[model samples]
Target: MSITEKAHRRSSRSLKALFGVLFATIVLGVTLAGGMSPATAAETPTPAPAPTEESDFTNTYSIGGVLRNGDEVLEGVDITVEGDGFSETATSDEAGEWEVVVPGKAEYTVTLEVSTLPDGVELRNPDAASSVVTADQWLTTSITRSFPMGEDTRETTGFGAQLLQRLVSGLNFGLLIALAAIGITLIFGTTGLNNFAHGEMVTFGAIVAWIFAVLLGVNIFVAMAIALVFGGAFGWVQDALLWKPLRRKGVKLVQAMIVSIGLAIVLRYLYLYFIGGETKAMNVGLSEAVQLGPVRITVASIISMVISVVVLVLVGLFLTRTRIGKATRAVSDNPSLAAASGIDVDRIIRIVWVIAGALAALAGVMLALYRQVSWDMGFQILLLMFAAVTLGGLGSAYGALVGSIVVGLFVELSTLFIPADLKYAAALVVLILVLLVRPQGILGRRERIG
Candidate 1:
C-alpha cells in the first residue's frame, strides 16, 4: 500500500507540472499575437516622418515649347506668359525653344507678341494671339505658334490632298494601337488571359511620364525610360501577386478573365482619383506643320510615326529571331508541351508580361502626344484595341498589327463619309464584316476538324 501510494502521488505532481507549463505557453502566445506590453510599445520607434510641405516646392512648373516656320527656327521672338499677380517673358533660343517658370497652379495666357516678329513672318492663326493655359501642377506646357512666310489666306485643299492628310493621320493612330495591341496579344498567347486591365497599363505609363517630365522636370527621354522600367516592374508584380497565385490555385480561365475586368475597373477609378479629370499636355509643345508632298503633318507626328514603325519592326524581328522571343512563342503555342521541352514556363510568362507592360506604356505616351492625357484615355481606345486584336486573331501578334492598321485607317478615313464622332463606330462595323467573312481573323490559324 505504501509503495503504490508513493508512486501515485509522484505521478500526480508530474502531471500538474506539465499542465501548468502548457497553460503558461498558451497565455504567452495570446499576448504576443495581440500586442506588446506597454513598456515595450513605448520603446518602439515611430515610423519615418512623412515628406514636408516645403519639399513639394522642389518641383517647379514652367511653360515652354519650340516655335518654327516649316524647318526654320525663330529666334529672339518674345513669348509672354501672363496671369493675375504673375507674369514671365522668354525669348526663343537658336533652336526656337522658349521656357519660363510660373509661380504655381493658376490659369495663364500665353501670347506671341506680333510686334516682336520679323517683317515677312506672321502668325498663321490670328486668334492664336493669346492661348489660355491652366497650370495645375509643375508641368511644361507647349505654346507653339506657326509663322507662315506669306500672308494668311484660306486656300481650298483638293480632295486628294485631304485624303492623303487623313491617311497619314490614320497611319499614326493605327501604329499607336498596334503597339498596345501586340502587347495584349503576346500576353494572351502565353497565358491565355485576355487581360482587360492592359488598358490601365497604358494610362499608368503616360501618368508616370507626366509626373517625371512635368512635375520633377526630368528630361523627357529619361522620364520615358523610367516609365518603361516601372511598367515592366509593375507587370512582374502583378503576375507574382495575382495571376501566378490564381494559376497555382487552378482557377478557371473564365474566372481569371472576370478578375481582370474587376481589376480594370479598380485601376480606372484609381487613375481618375490621382490624375484628376482634366487633360494634361506633354512638354513637346506644338510642332510646326511641314508640307510632305500633298499632306501637311506636324514634325512631332512624323517623328512619332517613325519611332513607332521602327520599334514595331524590331519587336517583330525579336519574336522571330531572339532566344527569349522564340521561347515566348513556344509557350504561347502550347504551355504544357513547352514546359515538357525544358522551357521555364513561368519565367517566359513573366517576361511576356514585362514586354507587354513596356509596349503598353510606350503606346500611352504616344497616345498622349496625339491627344491630351486624360483619366479615361486608355479605356476610350480599349474597344478599338479589342477590335484590332480580334481582327488580327486573338493570339497572333502580327495579326494584331495588321488589324490595328485596318481599324485605324477605317476610324480616320470613314470620317469623310460619316461624322467624325461616328468614325469609331464605323471601324467596329468593319471589324464585324471582316469577322463574318474570315471567322479565324487575318492571321489566326484555322482549326482542322476530323
Candidate 2:
C-alpha cells in the first residue's frame, strides 16, 4: 500500500521477469547452436568419432535389420547396405540389431556376409543372402529389413497373445497422444484456433532433447527435463509475440487459423533448415522390455506412460479443484462472460498455451524414444491429434483424452486386418463413422452439437 512497498514489489517482479526471459533465450540459443554444431564441427564431410560403430551423427534415417534364429540372436554378422552414392557396413550386436545410417530416402541393397557369421549361425535360406529394400522419406522411422538365420522350432505367439500386446502398446501410445491432444483441446477451447504450429512445438521438443541427450552426451532424463522447460518457454514466447497481438488486433478466427498455417510452414522449414531433413533419436540404443504378466513393454514406455498419467491426473485436479482452472473452464465456455466476471481471459489463455506446449513437447520426447525423430514427425502425430480431438468432440478436453485412446487402439489394432499404411486411413474412417452417428463425440455435451 505504501509507495516504497509498491516500488519494491514492482522491482522484484521485473527481476523475476528478466530472469525468465534470460533462461528462455539461453535455451533457444543452445538448441539453435546445436543445429549448427554438426555443420560447423567438421570443415567438410568427415567421419564422426566411431562412425562405423555407434556414432554421434545428427542424421537419423537408417537401414536396420535384426538377425535371429527362432529364439537365438545372431551377432557379429557382417551386413552391408548401399544406397545411391552411399555405402555402410554394420555388424550385428549382441541383440541382433544392426543399422546402417543412410543420407536420405532411397532404394538400397543390403547383403549379409555368411562367412562372418559364427560357426553355428547361418542364413536359413541361402537364396536370401542379399535383398533390396526401399527407404521411405518424411518421418519414416527406420526402413527395416529382415533376414532369417538358423532354425530352432519355437511356436509362434497365439492371436490372443498378439492382440493383448498390441492393446498394451496402443495404451502406451494413447497416453502420449493424450498429452498432446489434451493440449490441443485446451488451446482450441480457450482460443478457438486449431494451432497447427503445435505440431512444430512437438518437433521442437524432440529435436532439442536429441541435441542434448545424443549429441552433447547429457543424461537422457536431464535432457528431457530441459526439453520440458524449453517447451513451456516456447508457448510463452508465442503468446507474447504472436497470438496475443493478433487477439488484440481483433483478428478473425479464420484469419488467425490461416496465420497458424503460415506459422507452421515457417517453423517447420526453419527446423528443416537447422536440423536437416533426417531422423534422430533422443535415447541411445533401445529400452529393455519389461514383461508385465501377459504383456511386455519397454522401460522407457513405462516411464512415459507413467508421466502422462500423472500429468493428466494433475490436470484433472487443477480443472476441477483450483480457482484458476475453474476460471479456465469458464473462459472456454464463454470468454466474454468470464472476462466480465473479473476473470483475466488473456492471462488464462496464455496459461493454456504454456500447458499445451509443455504437454506437446513431452509427447514429442516420448515419440523420439520409441519411434524416429524427424522434422515432420509432429505433423504426422498432429493428424491423429486432430482426429482424436474431433472424435472426442471439437472443443472438449476430457473428450479429447477418451478419443485419443480410442484412436491409438484402433490405429494399432487395425493392422491385424488392414495394411499398416492403411491403418491411419482406417482411423480417419472410424472418425467419420463416429461423427455421423453422434457428431458431438464421446464425452461431449449435447450443447456442443448444433
lDDT of 1: 0.82
Task: Tell me the lDDT of model 2 at 165.
Answer: 88
Stretches of candidate 1 off by over 4 Å are 1-152
Angstrom error of the Cα, residue 377, model 1: value is 0.7
What is residue 48's positional error in candidate 2, in angstroms? 19
Worst 10 residues of 1 by lDDT: 138-147
lDDT of 2 at 53: 45
Candidate topping lDDT: 2
Candidate 1, 211-285: lDDT as tens digits? 888889987778778988988888887787677866765566887787788678867876775567789988665
lDDT values, one for every candidate: 0.82, 0.84
**Candidate number with greatest TM-score:** 2
Using all chains and alpha carbons, the TM-scores for the candidates as numbered come to 0.67, 0.71
Candidate 2 has its poorest 10 consecutive residues by lDDT at 14-23
